[model samples]
Target: MRIARLDTPAGPRHAVALGDRWHVIASPFAAPLVYTGDSIPADEAVLLASVDPRVVVGIGHNQPGHPLPMQAWHKSVHSVAGSGDDIYAVRDVGTVNIEGELAVVIGTSATNLTLENAFEAVLGYTVANDVTNVDQCPIDQRNFQGKSGKNYTPLGPWIETELADPENVATEVVINGAVVANSGSFNLPSSVAATLVYVTKWLTLEPGDVVLTGAPGTDLPVQPGDTVDITLAGIGTLSNTIA
Candidate 1:
């Protein structure tokens, strides 16, 4: 099922997609998927980030030929932004790169999980734009400053809870109406389950936490007034503009 969070006047609300409408539902992490019998037209609903992640984890430099299969980093929770929001450039860094990627949302707390059960902790999958400023510092430093900035990560449109074959999903990045990078899960060096296992060995991910699976292809830089669209097939597109 496709799930989304809406920005209602009352506050943020969880919703489920049914036909062409978004039916309000209870929190997916709290109780069963029960509809609240309230809904809005899918095209009319205002969206928020698919989940309110407390911790945003990133798997960087996981593309083929990287010495380390998994290079992890942390993005501040404040970096999270929803689709249709404007992302401003950090004043300290002149160059900002956009990395379109598939993000995993944690449904349950996970620690030292094995590959067999890694997916059990996953709530769903969503699209992510892992914004970065490589100029902030050397990548070897695991530059928290480089990766973590306000409104840096743009996630959503919605989450896909019923992904059958994640490895076969396609990911694309479009900048200013041009397709710059085209990739897919099949190009990933490690499976999502394996990345989870590797990460859980060191850190425990709690509910509502997010894991960015890593970006593919070369980094694409953006300036103010540039529009970016990242799409993960079977999920949906996440569009944002640089301000």
Candidate 2:
């Protein structure tokens, strides 16, 4: 089911999109009457970020060609952006770039997990725009610095629970309706399960924690007022306007 958090006349509510209408679930934003049969006009609702995560962890160069040393694999990497924050082009220093990547939401707490059992720990999936400032540091340190910028990460649209095989999902990024970066689960160097296990080895993944699965080869610069669309097949699209 495609779940979304939208602004309702009553308040912000969690909803499950069923065809042309929406079914209101538990109100994470506000307490309201549970409307199991009530339907809201899709066009009138404002969609908000899907999950309010406690921590947003990012994986650097996890792709095949961008491999890092084994010693650096366990390092905690992240971008400065938090949920509901706007990403800015000015903070990127000089080389302002955006990376479209698949994000994984941990449903439950996991510690010292194995690849085979990693799937069970996942709550769902979402798309994330991993905004980076390429010119902030040297080529070797760019990934570390670029990821730490304020409001560098934007995620949401909603979490998808039906995607059992995240390793095979297709992801793409579009800039103002133009396809800029395109890749699939098949292109990833390590399996989603393996990456999850590797990540959990260092830190315990708590509920609602997010893991950005690294972007494809094509990395481009973005500016203010630009719309970035990050899409994951079977999940949903995450679009944000840079300010």
Candidate 3:
């Protein structure tokens, strides 16, 4: 099942994709999914960001390169934008980079969630493009400077509630109509389950919080007016224009 956040007359509403249509839900933020009985034509309902994550957690360099999840940081939740939205450049730091990542949506709050049950906290999966300002600062504060810029991450289309194989999901990044990166979510230095369990041991992962499972492949360069699309095989595409 795929869930989405839609733009309604009332406001942004949570919904579920049902074939060619979508039905409003009470709150996907709650588990097992609940519908509000209101429905609409899926194509007509404008899409917003799939999930409004409370906090965006990034696990940097967690792949097979350096030992441990080398670099971790917090991206401002305001950085979250939807597909079709514009990613503006920070005036002084004009360079931009795009990365494709698998985003995990947290469903339930947990503390010290054991590995044996870590997957239980996951609500679904989605695609994320970690947009970075490459005109970075010095080594010590670079990740902070480069990643914390406004509208620096674009996530969207929809959240896939039924991900068949979370471990080996494929990801792709296309810039200005060119495929610049291709990789899978498998065999990472740190697995999703492991990351979930580890992070929750200290932080309480409440519903709607998001954990970006790191970006894969090379970070491709993009410029103002360039279109960058990040797609996770089953989740759908997140496309944004650099402005």
lDDT of model number 1: 0.86
**Clashes found in each candidate (C-alpha, N, C closer than 3 A):** 0, 4, 0
Clashing pairs for model 3 are: none
lDDT of 3 by residue, 128-212 (tens): 8887776673553747778876678787888898898888888888888988888868835677777777778668889999988
- The 0-to-1 C-alpha lDDT of every candidate, in the order given, reads 0.86, 0.70, 0.81
Q: Spell out the clash pairs found in candidate 1.
A: none
The sequence of per-residue lDDT tens digits that candidate 1 reaches over residues 116-204 is 88989989999998888878767538668787777789889899998887767798889999999889877778887888988899999
The TM-scores, one per candidate, come to 0.93, 0.80, 0.92
In model 2, how large is the Cα lDDT of residue 74?
A: 20
Task: Tell me, by lDDT, which candidate is best.
Answer: 1
| RMSD list, candidates in order | 1.9, 4.5, 2.0
Q: For model 3, what is the error of residue 209's alpha carbon versus the real structure, in angstroms, after optimal superposition?
A: 0.2
Q: What is the lDDT of candidate 3?
A: 0.81
> Which of the numbered candidates is closest to the native, going by highest TM-score?
1
Flag regions of model 2 displaced more than 4 Å.
Answer: 8-12, 27-39, 62-86, 139-145, 148-150
Model 3 alpha-carbon miss at residue 34, Å: 2.5
Deviation of model 3 at 206, angstroms: 0.4
Better of 1 and 2 by TM-score: 1
* Backbone collision tally, model 1: 0
